[model samples]
Structure formats: structure tokens, C-alpha cells
Target: LDAFLDAEDVLKVEGRLSRSSFPNSFKHPTVIPPGHHVTNLIIAHYHETVKHQGKGFTINEIRSDGYWICGLSRAVATHIRHCVTCRRVRRPVESQRMSDLPVERAEPTRPFTYCGMECFGPFWTKQGRKQEKRYGLLLTCFCSRAIHIEMLEDLSTDTFINGLICFIALRGAELDMNRLNVFLTEKQCDFVMNAPHASHAGGVWERQIRTVRSVLNATLLLSPDHCATMAIVNSRPLTADALDGHNRLEPLTPNHLITMKSTPALPPPGKFEREDLYGRKRWRQVQYLTEQFGSRWKREYLHSITTRQCWHSTKRNLQVGDIVM
Candidate 1:
């Protein structure tokens, strides 16, 4: 260390670059002490000078400006580790572990007992040489994953009420128009409204809307009609494909729960295989198919949802009095 210092009373590094054309600061930089508050402040100044860059850039800036602190890299690193601006700009986003499934999602219940509702599309149809816009209202069963779709003439309240009434008539409901309290009492149901502008709260139906749009887009090339579109969407598989050489039973679908059918597609014409038949009686065959569906659904669908796809690790979430951008 003494060999590198100048003979002057003031301390500076007698670097070998004296003969070079470099600046005087680079030739003999000022030597600063390790672990000093002033050294840290100088590092921090250079840190901001480089716009809060990483350690390597900040160290280069400090050395280029004529200061040579002992253990410079370690000092810069320590200062930046606790730097508020650096943390705010570079820290990973806060996330908590994925939440548990609600009772409506986890429990096996009657189809449509607990359901999500959403409106999508403005499909155009021609009637009497004029084109009219139509919208679809979707009600998805929270348990069975089955869906019921209704087409609305317009977004008007009366039009929506009529469509809703049609849905209730087919799926079932009650009516009481006189008193608000009486209506609420007679309904025996709760309407949960998600917070305004918080669409994440309706993720269930929101995701379903994407699925519906995908199916609609694919089928539009084949048939522009929405009725057929609904049929195709409702027939989509509820579970991932389970087909294998050993497993002959088809993948379960929403149609199985809604209509007790394997698929909306007609079965291919062929002689009935012995393995396909459950019993001699017709009712026995129906009961057997239902039981098969129930068992497969419980084993496959329930298991699939048990594990979180993302956000598996828990992290500290924002608390009260926390500052955010």
C-alpha cells in the first residue's frame, strides 16, 4: 500500500498510469478510508449519478471521478442493498400463495345451484333484408361446469329481463313484483355484485368468456349462427384429455352433467362392443354411464384443481400504510 501512495503529505494512489495520456484523476486517484460515512455518501452520489445503476457501473463512476476507496465494490454493494430507490425500482412484484377454492368451486352440488353469469358478443343476424345485432348471456354452473346460454335482442333492461325470464323458465325461478322486501324473501337467493372496475373478482366467468369466444370464432367459419355456437361451447371438455389405450371411457364433459351424454357429437355407426355394454337392461346402462361420469369427474377434475398452477410460493403482501405507485 505504501509503494502505491505518493510522497506528498496528502494521500493518493501513485498508479502506474502516470506516463499514460489518461486524466490526472485516473493517474493518481484520491484514497478514501473503508467503512466511512463519507465514503458511503460518495458511493451513493455516484449511484444516483449513474441513475441508480447496478454495482459495477456505480463503482466505475466513483473510480473515474478520482476517488479510490478501499473495498470499494463491497461498500457500494452494501449501500445499494438498502437503497430505497433501488429497491422500489428493481424488487420483484409482491405475491401471496394462491387462495383456497371456495365452497361453490370445491363442493359437488346440483348443477346451477351456484353459478356465474356474464354477457358477451354482439353477433349480427339478418332478418327481412335487415341486419340486427344480438348478444349472448351465459350462466355457468359452478359445480358441474355446465353452461346455459341465452341470446338477447338488445342490452335494454326489458330485453335483458325477458332473456333472464326465459332462462329461469327453462332452468327454473320465482316471481314477486309487488314489494322489494317480499321479492327478496320469495327469491331465497343472493346476488353477489363484484366491486366496480375489479374484474379479477369475476375471474371464473371472465375466463369462461374467453373460452366461449374461442369456440365461437372457430365455429363461425362453419356456421355464423349463435345457436349452433352455444351447442359447440356447451359440449367442450371439462377435464383435460384422458384418452389412453388402456382407458376406453371418454373424457368427461359439461354435456355429461347437463344432459347425461358423453358428447354432443353423434356416435359413429358400428356394432356395439361387449366392453361398452354395462348390463342387459336399458335403465341399467343409463345408471352405469351416470355412475362412471360421477366417479371420473370426482377423481380427475377435483384432483386437477387441488394444485395451484402459479403463485405456489407465499410472499409478503402489501399491508396498511404501505406506499405504492
Candidate 2:
């Protein structure tokens, strides 16, 4: 009944239009409201249905179907193109703009390198009601991509120098330390001028710090533990690839992803014969061991052990007149 009545009303309107000699062009199977055109209808339908439904359709897709007409005047097309919402939602088709300066290629002999240092943490320690902060240091050699990390209670001048000394002593053996022509850092005053070596200022290390922070955050989000964080970081391809630039590099962690032959263990020192126990003989043995094993031994063992002792000796030791707080 309601449908029949609606049909009857539409027919009556159609008949009245015919008798009144209304424009034949306006007589269509469906009569849209006054002031509403096909374009408006299509635009409304696109926004309400297609865009709202989370499906993306191009302007051409809308026009190819009868839903939108392709024969719209240039003015109309331009207006639609200028629509702020549509412009915002559209994916840009043009390539990004290039810098005004010409791109310079790296020198044939020079290749990119990366280095990083760890700033120690547990950033705060509670004492009574107060907290103490500590930070660790890390440095990396770009060409070799070898890394050195240190822990320090503060970023004082002396601490910086000491940390850097340990770093250089451990990792600088392979390089002609004189060949370290340039150092790049993220605008850190300590890292920039802590040493007399060449240094360059840039945000590269800062950006790297952010990336590391993100990695750590994501890792901790899954499992908040040092082991888990390190595992996740070491599992990444970038970590191994970054470290491989060093000549004598080994995996940064205890676990190895690939199997390989193991090197033979060094023989223990032979018993000191009377002749061998002489000062010159002992001195030669010490020199030989230092030359052969100093770098690796420092990296693997001495660094951590000595750092703890150094901290204790410097700060924990009390003097005769020292005020014990």
C-alpha cells in the first residue's frame, strides 16, 4: 500500500510535468531534488559510502561508472582537485624535491663507517631519600666498526679521558692510530672535544641514539630484562653486519649463529727455569704476552674487572682526614 501510493504520487507529478510543457531534458526516470546535480550526488555518495567504508577509489573509478560524469568542465575538475580534504587524503605522485647542491660522490678510497658507545645506566641509584645517577660510555671506530663501552658515574673531564684511553688502548691497536683523521659525533661536547683527535659535529649519533632507544623500548615492551634486550638487539642483522667491519671481529655475544672450527687454546706458561726466571727473561715474556693478547684480553676481561676496581679505588677509598658521610 505505501509503495503503491508513492508510485501513484510520482506518476501524478510526471503527468503534471508533461501537461505543463516542462523541459523534456528534465524528465528522467528519477527526479533528483532541485539544486542537486549528478556531480553533487556522486560526491556525496563517495564521501558517505566509499570513503567512509575505508575503501579507496580513484576519481577515474568514480567517473568510469555512471556514478560520476567524466565530461565535467575543466572548472569543476579544478575545484574538486583543490578540495582540501581530498588533497590531504591523496597520495602524492611526484618524487621528493632534491637539494639545490649537486650530489657529491664519496672519495674512491673512502667508504661509510659506523661506531657507537654505550652510556651506562641504572641512571639513578637510591641512597637514603636521594638518588645518584650514573652513565656508561661507548665509542666505535668507523672504518673498523669496532666498539668500546665503558661505565662511569659521571661525564667529568677526567672520567672522559680515562674512558677514552681504555677505548683506544683496546681497539686502537689494529689501526695506525695516526690515520684516525676524522671523528664524527652527535653534538656531544665530551665526545667532540674529550680527546685531542679530529672531530666533526653532526646529529648522526643522536639519530642513532633515537633508533637504539626505539629498539630498546620495543624490546622491553615485550620483555623487560637486560638479557632479553641484548638478545633482541644481537638477533638483528644490522648488529652483526655493523661489527663485521673490524678485522679481528668476533660475534659480540657468546652465542654463534653459524658453526665453525674453533681455534686451539694457548699453552700454559712453562715452569720458570733458573735462567728463564731472570729479570730480562721475565720482562721479555711479559712484553710478548702484552703485545699478543693485550687488546683481546682487555676487551674480553680486563675492561669490566678494572673498571670496578678503578671506581672503588678512586671513590670508595677513605683517607685519614676524609669525612666519612
Top candidate by lDDT: 1
lDDT value, candidate 2, whole model: 0.37
**Residues 1-325, candidate 1, lDDT per residue (tens digit)?**
4425456655888867879999877878999999988887898899999999899999999989998899998888888888889889997766679899888888765567687887877866667687787788888777777777778877776666666667677765522122433443555545565688767667778887787778766764322455576667667777665766685567777767767533322223343434555657665455556556666778888788788887888777788966554
lDDT of every predicted structure (CA atoms): 0.72, 0.37
Clashes by residue pair, model 1: none
Each candidate structure's TM-score, on Cα atoms with residue i matched to residue i, is: 0.75, 0.29
TM-score of 1: 0.75
Clashing pairs in 2: 117-138, 117-139, 118-138, 119-136, 120-135, 120-136
lDDT of 2 by residue, 1-325 (tens): 1111134454112323345444533322232233346556655555444453222343434433423233334423544554555555663532222222111111110111224344544344445687676454644333222233454568765675566556555434222111122221221222223232322132223433444456545543321233354444334432323254557455333122111102112323544333443567655554444333323433543333223212132223346863222
